[model samples]
Target: MSDTTQAPAATGSTPASGRPAPRFPLPALIVMACTTFIGIVTETMPAGLLPQIAGGLRVSDGSAGQLVSAYAVGAVLGAIPAVMLTRGARRKPLLCLGLLGFLLANTATALAPDLPVALAVRFVAGAFSGLLWGMLAGYAIRITAPERAGRALAIAMTGIPLALAAGTPLGTWLGTTVGWRWAFAGTALFTAAILAGALIVVPDAPGQHAHTRIPLRKVLRIPGLATILAVVFGWLLAHNLLYTYIAPYLRQEHLDLTPDVALVIFGVAAIGGVWITGTLVDRMLRRLTLASLGLFIVAGVILLAAHGSTPLAILAIILWGLAFGGSATQLQTAAGAATGEHADAAISMVTTAFNLAIFAAGAVGAIIVDGVGAKSLPAVMTILAAVALIGVGFGRRAAFRTGR
Candidate 1:
């Protein structure tokens, strides 16, 4: 398709000689960001309110915890098929449908009468989460100019750190104070507003042409796609290994700290990381990615060597969050750039890899905590971070190319 085919409203088309492109589409981008915020807050708030959820559903805490697991599993299973099936649909309508699906699922979860029913709805919510995530990279790219794709993606993902840092905590507090059901309902209301905003402001884009569409198998064969995905898996695996079990890791260190306090520091630092990445990603994608992974290793080393020093532990957590904050943007941009027209398919793969890492981290981290103990988590994270670093270094010519 020619430049004329790009969505007139959304496209950050290059301006005439000596003229600047239009300003960033902040309103549209914020709508997308809010979608992410709702998805994450819905998925994680259950964790913070597990006690309430358990009592309400008449289930054990262990069983209640599976609400999170069910969601992750659904995401892993949902992204690929959803993206493949919807590849030819109009962008805005498809996004709206995904939002509606997610909203209903979350509402169902809030009203579920038993553990089985809650788990089922949570799974459905996760499936919708996968659908939304699968589209984000391609959506960001489609809505912006090439030079601004990375920055656009960074903005679209702004919801993540905020959701992790503040949204979940606040939702948890609300659930505990009023009831778990209200928490989900509150997010549902927010989702409704975002959906309306998306309908009003987000531009419509035509799906891939029939002649240009390729099968998922071939998309996977695209050069650099696999390497980018490998990096995604390794890098996130290392992060989740520590993140999923952060409380245990903190307790094992015997530092005078709470997980909430540590995570707040991490989340706040992550905001800085996001700003730095958005500023330089278009120019230094490769350099920034490598630096992030390297810093991840350095953070692990600090934790390994610091013993129980509270100050050092807090510092390490900050570094760790900073390393992770831009990860989704960097990796998704690489995948989209690598595949070009197949960006949607490549992004679906990236999404799947990310959720797989989440599942793996929980399962594998448990084994380590049971067998070697939480102290060993950092050592393992360091090793995996090095592996991810090597992947990025080697992938430079293919996936992590130097420029936008």
Candidate 2:
């Protein structure tokens, strides 16, 4: 764990500084990006398809919603363990296996007879997706230059925003038009295609951690790691609190736009946000973090004060997407900066925090939705956004100390 770890040789030549030599391979990056996109689609597409899934399986909406948590529970229970278990395996095979696993999970969900079976298959499948998520950023960064880690992560992560913007809506339509199961079948097909691409394209680099077990203690001891991760946790938690109920909130509040239209607006804005972060994160990391977190706060307030105005609701969601989407890239970049040499370990921890938040966010959102109502989310988001802002303040100070 003391910086002698081997990087994926297929990435580029290693320098004494331990960063990979600059040799950008755009095609490989694209494959990885596509893989990440499908991974996200598998994780999130269910949110918009809940009603269809419930009707198909003869279950309640609440039970169908558990599909989201089932995946997260898999991530929470399986992501770290998957990475650790596959530590000695070559990078390409591990990733390929993970991708292939998604096809099986989604296909099983598509064919599942009952809710319990769907949840079980989804959990097992989630374990695989979690491995992909937990290891992906590190793999993407490792195969590229160190200074461009942010760019590499940004490109790889573009899939996330795109999934939100396009994948879920398409899944909803597929569920609505054809059948709920087809939506999952569509995901299976998508995952298979990406799996084939990954198998063919990604360089067969030896596993970076083959000789170096992630020193959990060492990573935790890294300066400011905790604060940066807190920002990650709080950011996702805040977003999911309301996002988990976005469709209903929009309908009940009479936002004028259909939920589909709203997601389109939000998705497009999110893509813009991630693009901005990718362009600026490497050059202006701290500044970008503060600004995005601030925008998220303003977005929460916009929702609180929307007062049923169509324009305000749209504006609020746009702002939300811009801030939240960018924040994801910014945070992963910070995680890179925080652990410097221990990128994989640091990213794994970040992934754990991220999915754990996703798991918790839905449950917490459900509580709020059932109790105080979706209207209460704006106030709660403001509070969490404020907390994330403070996390950024303390986190930068923590990351700065690592420079010593």
Candidate 3:
């Protein structure tokens, strides 16, 4: 769908020039990118439409927040099993099946009439989302040149920020203008397009290894794997604690912004951040990771100062978005580097940690918001950001020791 296609190379083959080798067909990359875009959009739409959904379903705002949490929980639980179950499956078929599952789950969300059903559907949607993302990362790496793997991954991940920047706003507008159901209906449509694109473009690619499958436990035992997981867990926990509650916090503060306006601002800032960070990640992975963590801390401080100032708060959020946009990519790269041969398992573990962070953040933010009021949002976020920074310090030490 996007006019981006680089020629594919042989799968799992080393570069002939003793450099990074290209692994998959260019068309397959495009298909995977499209699927990634739809996956992100489906995953994040609920964040933008929380208030409307809460009102429509007659649930507490906290209960409505569970829609986001449920998906994160499902993703945390689903990634490993999916990877293990489909260990040696062809990439194209797995991609197709994952997207198909996502399509069905989103459709279920669109048609659900009750809160429980909606939450359940969101969880299923999340499960599919995890499988799709995990597979995409591994598939991209397997199909691309070693030197180009970072760029390829960046290209694939571009879908996430694009979905956040463009898709979320569109979904929010649709939710406000039509109904929240239409937002999910839109996701289903996009997923269908991605599915079609995959069918038309992706070639049948073989598995990365014929007989070498790393056990999950062995994968987890990589030197810095546990530390990296801790760092990502902390980073995401802090980021989502603020992010998941942002829309509702802004509303409760009686800020002079509508839901659509806020969502647009968030989407734009997030995309800008992702674009900048994506490029940086391809070059200076570790340096950028440290820089992003610092920026996140600064964003939290700025948010604290901009507590009641709408324009200032918007500016702060944009910075926060930029910081967070690079976070997962940075951590994913770190995990891959740490577990050189077990890239698939490393990817799965990182995915799991990320989802768990989302679930933890949402649950914690809800309690904080209910007990402390919206004005306390920045302070809470600031504290979490500080914690993330501390984790980064540990990550830096671990990286230094491991020579990463």
For model 1, residues 6-119, the per-residue Cα lDDT tens digits are 233445555666566756777888898898888889888988998999999888999999999999989999999999888888889988998999889878887888999988
Task: Output the better candidate (2/3) by TM-score.
Answer: 2
Measured by lDDT, the strongest candidate is 1
Better model by TM-score, 1 or 2?
Answer: 1
User: lDDT of all predictions, in order shown?
Assistant: 0.86, 0.79, 0.73
Give per-residue lDDT, candidate 3, residue 26. Answer: 62
TM, every model:
0.95, 0.89, 0.83
Reference-based lDDT, residue 335, model 1: 84
Instruction: Name the TM-score of candidate 1.
Output: 0.95
Residue 165 of model 2, lDDT score: 88
Model 1: lDDT to the true structure: 0.86
Q: For candidate 2, lDDT tens digit of each residue in 243-295?
A: 77787687667778887788788889999998888776766777777888899
